[model samples]
Target: MTETMNNVLNDDKKWKIIQGDCLKVLEGFAPGSFDAVITDPPYASGARTQADKQKSTRQKYSSMGDNAPPAFEGDAKDQRSWTRWAAEWLAEARRIAKPGAPVCMFIDWRQLPAASDALQWAGWIWRGTAVWDKGNSRPQRGRFRQQAEYIVWGSNGDMPISRPVPCLPGVFKYGNPGKRIHLTEKPLQLMRDIVRICEPGGLILDPFAGSGTTVLAGVLEGYRAIGIEVTDVYAILAQERIVRELAEAV
Candidate 1:
């Protein structure tokens, strides 16, 4: 085991935020160390350039330009790159996740296939998919207004499985309250649902923990969370959010 893994094994804290590349940090964890995995990673939607500043300005009259920072610039281009990256992470997750542990990954419709393929290739049994319908979504120029995202749930082993809850569906609806810090911050309710389904009190891992939504959910649900964030800004924001949440709980 690596020094980082050793530290994690030694610590008994309920939550931790690790500022580093997920690929590197995942290497430090031992196989079957975590009980669950929930994450929202970059969609690799071929959106490298910043959004049009003028367009953004026109839409919201905000000082920030229309062209938001490219969320997937550091990663490779195309779905193939995303598939490979996700597969790599899933491989690590599978190793660190307990038998029959659930792994839930968030993705947009455009990238769902690749995400599913990546998870299957990484040895997870593709159980089913769930949808998050954000009621307050923006109007789309073409096609139906895109208001829904997806969560692909997989398991570490293949066998008869029990539903995490007595009654849960593959789809759910939530309001898009907008993100406070991260570009693609997931809703708290969504996180809460995932935690409820997965059950609490075990170590939950979020490899691409943007803005710390998953971590916050884990903390609130009484589960130990370990988050890895690539960007320094997001890392700081996640840590701040965790501290604030913990303080509020007291």
Candidate 2:
């Protein structure tokens, strides 16, 4: 749907989902409007094979094939192209993020450099990275099974940002022990941890809000969240998930 036509849901204190292209929706907001940003963007893991697509859509969590790659395979025409795309989104993120506000981008090893470079180019100073160890027991064939992901944190160089919690060192282990609705969906506990550490109150933004996990975390934590998703199917699913989460909260 066009940005103008996308629906914006208004609920109690919770941030609602906005269905549209993130770049377009974000352009309409004032600069430095968000307190913090916790997002998981697409890793550009290359084009999905028809079989890959089918498997992603149909396989149960327990039934995924051995050959299936991790949700994001770090796909791009080249490293340069990947950096360009990341730069575009990150620049916008910097514009909307308050001075010294923390911007957390979730990524894997393959895309970490590119994501970090984009953040630097967008004027955010590199602070540190957080490792989220997803407790998965599967073993890989050639390499060690990746049980973790990274979150790069940065802030605008010139301003004072709020640090709601003390920064913790070492990796954070989060267990995901159930069926998966969205491929590459992060656990809710992970999102909650990030939110708690960042302490975003006015609004939390997630550009690539797959399945609405981040938004749900924000809502549950008593912060308004704004998310953008390209696919209608995911947007619908995210909304449904939010409804269920809200219902459970009551």
The number of the candidate with the highest lDDT is 1
lDDT of 2 by residue, 31-129 (tens): 777778789987654234434433332242334666432332223335577688778878887887877677889888777888899888877888889
- Candidate 1 per-residue C-alpha lDDT over 1-250 given as tens digits, one digit per residue, 9 for 90 to 100: 4656736633457788888888888888877788789998877553534353213212322233545422322433466776888899899889888888889999888789999999999999998999898876568677687788999998899533464544567778877545456656788878978866565477889998878899898878878888999888788888998899779978
Q: What's model 1's lDDT at 55?
A: 30
- C-alpha TM-score for every candidate: 0.84, 0.80
Segments in model 1 whose C-alpha atoms lie over 4 Å from true places: 1-3, 9-12, 46-76, 140-142, 159-165
Task: State residue 100's C-alpha deviation in candidate 2, in Å.
Answer: 1.3
User: Predicted candidate 2: what Cα RMSD to the true structure?
Assistant: 4.8
**Shift in Å, residue 175, candidate 1:** 2.0
Candidate 2 clashing pairs? Answer: 15-224, 15-225, 44-75, 45-75, 46-75
The model with the greatest TM-score is 1
